[model samples]
Target: MKIKSLITALAAGMVLSTTAVKAEGNAFRCAEGETYYMNVMVSGVEYWFPVYEMFKQAAHSMGCKTAYTGTPEYDVNKQIASFDQVLAKKPAGILVHPMNSDPFIEPINRAVESGVPVVTFAADSPNSKRISYVTSDNNREGAYAADVIAKALGGKGEYGILENPGQDNHDKRVAAFIARMAEKYPDIKLVARAASNQDPTKAYNAVLTMAQAHPDLGALFMPEANSALGAAQAAQELGGKIKVMNADVNGKILDMIKQGQVYGAINPNQGMQGYMGFMLLFLAAHPDLIDPMNDYKRASYNPMGLPVVDNGFAVVTKDNADDFYWDAYLKRRGTKGIEE
Candidate 1:
């Protein structure tokens, strides 16, 4: 709330932190003709495109260049090959968002050991020694989603969660949502938990099957974007028999929200993550001024605080959807704030 107010008046070339964006300061200023290159990594979903576009624009503004690459789907082998390609090019720095937390540890470690000043964004590789992570407080986000659903159901409805059970990020988010609901709302009953494998068709079938089998099911909570999209289709076909709450934003989901066909989404400030990732990498390569790992946090962060930066999320509903009008960077990427 406070942060939104601040952003309303931000001038060009300002870097928005949770607290403030300086008057004359910018995110970073690169040296003339400095070949600062970064690879923006992601495990592709509908959600990753906007983020990469944001990073690319930010790099351009700072007089640097960037390459965007990732596995188009959630394939470990494909992701590894992509990571290797980025490393082989030996960019000034690297920013990777791993598909799974543990499997990518070795590759991330190699990136760091080779002095690549890597930072994880969105989905993180926590076990690996990535410099910093930029993402929403996923647990907090889950709790928030649960709160919304519980209130909507009047605290006493039977519900189910369509989960991507093995992914650490999704697992933690779902767990947080569940724990918060149990702690705060006593009578809400959880009927079932289904793994949707982050597939839209699978989620649609699962939701259709569940709705048919359990006529009493009042709501469905989905934590992955594809599943959420599938659940949207199911909700549409079910003729409003079920209520849904889920994470991430997409063109399809935004339209569903506008039509009151699906519930709101918890959306990460992904553009900011890409913007910050570029800033961190640029700073790491150009400066002996601050130690990328130690000194930077001490200088510009809340010390008695959260370790990772919470870029925060804008809870998008029809009422507030207009607040997130497409920026120039988003338009350049061919996304008109959830337009199909």
Candidate 2:
């Protein structure tokens, strides 16, 4: 009886030990001091705050660390320099929003070659060796904005666009807006196109000039929030004759929407962009975590090669503007907005 009892106790102990080993092996938490980073140009912009908040949240959930780094300026060269500085830290991975696509190819490729994974959000370097791209569908957002503006104008008025010429995503938005207007609403004329370059003063002057040149201009569209501020001010000056719509929203944009100064906005799902971007970077950095039966292993490619991820978007109108307020969101979150 004593021998049988001893054997049973030893078997139970072995089973428990095996279970513990398996648990440890399967755990997804990060190693001590392992960190990931979110990098962008125009780092001080309000648009990036919500994004990094979610990225930080996702990292913390996985017992990992996260940091936000980038240049406050819009210059692509400065952005690349900041990216290189982050790379010098040898972080576990990075999530970057390249200001322009082509200029980032070499730097991104170099990072990937050095075994540091990179995932881009909001913009892309398609020719680079980055593991993944995460963003809303810019074409769809532009087309949708066109439809909204056209419908508001009753389909037979002139409209103009404020552009940021060099950025890939911004260019796509402008192109698709024009194309959609041409394809679906031939009666609506595109009378003016001006390069705002994301400058409020430029957008203000452009909108004012376009409205003057084309007295029948019923609507205006821009690809970003800053330009919208100036555009909306111009529209208000014109006694709100022109409806202003833009791609992204800030607190001021939401206020304008609420006050009927701006028509509406197509807002990207920034939280999802950050969360999924970090996940992609983490997976790319730790390719050994997954071993699905695929050709990636044989081809000497990273198993986590996700080419594009559409994080999705939302249309913000007066009805839902309150729900999108960044200040309200931060207050609910109980954290400093972007300071941490």
Candidate 3:
């Protein structure tokens, strides 16, 4: 689809409409002393920017301020330290995507105990004291990918996975996909599983190695978009026989899907995650609003419980690939929120 047509589709959804929504809202006051922060490792990754942008949008709409700060590289210790550093400044609240589940337990606990509301997004620490967790249902995403690919191949072929192990969300995706295949399509054999670390080159090399090992491999799945780029290139070079499916979408991935270089993608509603994440933190931070049922100053328990929000996802193929582009969404929304 052309950029113009995509914009029209988005406008029809009422998400954003060329300055229509932005102009009407004074709900976001940006009042003095009302600021928040988002902390995550791998801030440089393409998938994260939209989440952060929508977080900002939610903050702005709610009359608050937000800033982005986290390690540019994927280093757990560094991210933890950055979390502590952000704590010292004491923003209204924080939304963090921990590199690992247990490593973030201490920092998240300390943040909550110190009265700084915290929520986790994308990746989460279930053992931690964070007030809320927001993300797509990763298990559902993996199952959907498996269903799409297995049915596309008619359920009797070998497939492989390019995995980024240990990260909670990525691990869940891989595990769920494997389980789905085993239970529903026993005829399909999983030929290989290799580490990609969310790197394009590594994924490229991994796919090539899988191809060499299983010459009759039918398909390959990765949990994230970055690795899909490399996997797509490798599939293209291998005469496009091995179908490639992955979770998440960006411009390049959508382009590949449209061009038939890649088969499909599972697109999480990342914007909804970001927006709801901020809302969770903000409400937790300011729990002074009167409750109709409860008496004044409800104490002991934090304002918000550790709720999990599954923002949901859409399966993207060539037929609707154009609707998932960030550039078109930004243009149609009429907000200069995210940079290309």
Best model per lDDT:
2
Identify the candidate with maximal TM-score.
2
What are the candidates' C-alpha RMSDs?
A: 8.8, 4.4, 9.9
lDDT of 3 by residue, 262-307 (tens): 9999888888888899988877886653244543355666656656
Give one digit per residue, the lDDT tens place, for model 2 in 227-310.
999999999999889999999999999999999999999999999999999889888888888898989877998999888999
Off by over 4 Å in 1: 1-44, 291-307, 322-329, 332-340
**What TM-scores do the predictions have?**
0.80, 0.93, 0.87
Q: Which digits, one per residue and each the tens of the lDDT, describe model 1 over residues 192-276? A: 7789977889889898888887778888888866787788788778888688888887777777788887788888988887777
Estimate candidate 2's alpha-carbon lDDT, on a 0 to 1 scale: 0.92
Itemize residue pairs with steric clashes in candidate 1: none
Q: Candidate 1: lDDT of 30?
A: 57
Off by over 4 Å in 2: 1-26
Among all windows of 10 consecutive residues in model 3, the one with the lowest summed lDDT is: 289-298
